[model samples]
Target: MLSPEADAPLRAAAMTWLTVRSNDGADPLPRHELESFHFEGERVPLIDRQRGIRKPAILEAALSIITVYRAEGTTRPYEDGTGSDGLIRYKWRGLDPDHAENRALRVAMERRLPLIWFVGVAPGWFQPVFPVYVAGEEPQLNQFALAVDEVFGLVEPETHLEAQLRRYVERVTKQRLHQPVFRSTVLRAYTGRCAVCALAHRDLLDAAHIVPDSHERGEASVRNGLALCKLHHSAFDNRYLGVTPDLTVHIRQDILEEQDGPTLLHGLQRRHGQKLMVLPGPRSQYPSKELLEITYRRFLEPA
Candidate 1:
């Protein structure tokens, strides 16, 4: 719920998605900062108001990627110091793994649809979000763990509850009607630097889609994005230019031959042959070559 403790992490994730990756000029959605953002507790659920049924499951929940914390003082040796393990343990709603909602979570994972969010709810009414994954669970004890990493930030309920310091079986489930949030992943992957010119201005850079968002191949992940500035973003989109999987920038001959002031010559035309300015430190986070090849074939080919 947009509490004081949550301000930093929420804003961080929001900045990555809303401000940083929000390049949708036509249908720009609301921009959220720490101070001015909507806050809600709970996951994307299947609710039938008429039937008086409320079954909660996360389905591409708008609040992306939060860290789930264990009840404040409950202890586990393998859980390490963070009140969390590399996995999470949750009880099935019916305690039956075969429940339709339960099965849907598995399907979501297999299909990799509706980018899964690592949401946390503490026994003491606390919650936080982190960029993590759901590694699935077992029927026995519903035992599981998060992919385990440093949490991005903390979010807590405005009305605090005394920490529930006991081991309780969490009802672990996941479901998504849409793909996962790719904006934060792409923006954070580059550490906020433009891939082409290496510009680091937070407001100036964007998580530019290597493939158009409409294409079936275009995923909303870092592997499908490059941190690009407004200028390169426009150029890249209009087919004024493109980058090879090897990270070489290529200028269309027409743009190269355009008769204009120094802006044309020094700006768009001169970028040819230069290597991409910055790539993610982890090779896995680098834009996918196969995806890049698709983009190159689509927009990089000469007219």
Candidate 2:
């Protein structure tokens, strides 16, 4: 059922399918139409459009894996070109192209010697098939094969596939999973101003997640974060400080009475209370009001 010789074309088709499917605000092609499409080069027809939506079994399976990976925020699909009415080309970019996983994908596709490891998807919604290789002396069939098969089985069966795939694409392309990058973006967006102190300082700034990273259901994104200085980030994380939806800073009353808390109390309470920081452009991307409400409640309670 599997042929190494067929791997290259299959992989190309699959990548193309995945790219088109993940495009935001775009319509997918009917499977029937996809079957009739022709691929350039290679005398053997890559897809049998005459079969009328009965795509190659392997192609369907490969699509499922691509969908899942896109959902996991590991990669992103982008439009490569546009010309034909209501049609578009697509491509993919992984977070770390130099990583072994991406390299393996390149080799399996037989793209080129020291292959670029990336490709563009043609117009259409049909799923594409590709080959996968497992490195081992004994051919570890269970791990590699089972993983691929599981993805294949999920292609059209999952109810939330579209929504999950969208979120995943944004996550991967934006590098949301990389905390440092996420943090830095938020900080840069705020121009290094502390959300609490309103003091702009390049050296002391940090991007703080309103909901701690551990509590974030998905990758830490700008939507769930804020820009704070080192002192404020630590204070906020420790529940010694909080911020309101209006961006006002709140220092816990109990901590203010401590014998050694004068410096913190004076610096935060007298100087910064009720004063709001100037948020960067696009308030929509700022920490959500709902998230701030939850964070404030936790900050007010006993730690």
Candidate 3:
């Protein structure tokens, strides 16, 4: 087997190869003849004895290091006195190494470390790597390769690739949840109909988050959304209106009792009460009952 130190160059080579393949949408160059692949306008020298060097093991280690750099935004030298050069020179090291970090790294490599690293680096990349299995002759590309491309192309050597990767993942995964995406999902869910009045007018529709975005753990998944018109979403968020745990609409009694309440209540009760905008999909992704309950209780509180 190749010494860990000797593997570093191979790891770098693999990353370069994967990046080239992805950019060109082509198959990776053959492993034994990898030196035929150009990197930075130059061909890397081939190892004299390919049999003695384990390409996958080298790739896995490189992937692990890249992943950690992407996730932690820092380079940590291996604990066994091995330097931060991407090679694990210690042949006697156990598979289940005693080091916590090393163990974590190993786990990440064997069990979709690239996916997790990609999620931290670029969540939109998740869709490509997801379901982990595909129905075709092409082998699934390693998910880490996505982040590796970004790191090699965009990141500074000293910069933590992990932090950048995390930012990318967050950006892509949540892209649809921004004002535009949020609005689109909501509008689509409602089919351009108002949640309150059943008013099927495109111009009047609004997409509203059932749970405020700030409180959400994941990016705005479709289930956490609703389609209301401008007035209802405003009133709903301001606690002037609320949805029941069962998704029924309710106008707050206090709002009805305020000055100008007669006009507001008359409009709301006539248009919205006892009705729900039927969600587009199965209720599983619909606003959670627990979330509705929490919003309802907050609305009912003496403020």
Those runs of model 1 whose alpha carbons end farther than 4 Å from true positions after fitting are 1-180, 300-303
TM-score (all chains, Cα) for each model: 0.47, 0.45, 0.43
Give the C-alpha miss distance for residue 303 in model 3, angstroms: 2.7
- The parts of candidate 3 lying over 4 Å away from their true place are 1-141, 144-179, 259-263, 269-273
Residue-pair clash count for candidate 2: 6
lDDT of each: 0.48, 0.45, 0.44
Candidates in descending lDDT order: 1, 2, 3
The candidate maximizing TM-score is 1
Which candidate comes out best when scored by lDDT? 1
Model 2 stretches astray by more than 4 angstroms:
1-105, 108-177, 216-219, 259-262
lDDT of 3 at 200: 75
Better of 1 and 3 by TM-score: 1
lDDT of 2 by residue, 1-31 (tens): 5444554465465446544542421222334
CA error at residue 246 for candidate 3, angstroms: 1.1
On the 0 to 100 scale, the lDDT of residue 171 in model 3 is 53
lDDT of 2: 0.45
Error of 3 at 273 (Å): 4.4
> Candidate 3, residues 83-171: lDDT per residue as tens digits?
12211121212233434434334443444333211111121111111111101110122111222222223432223446556556335
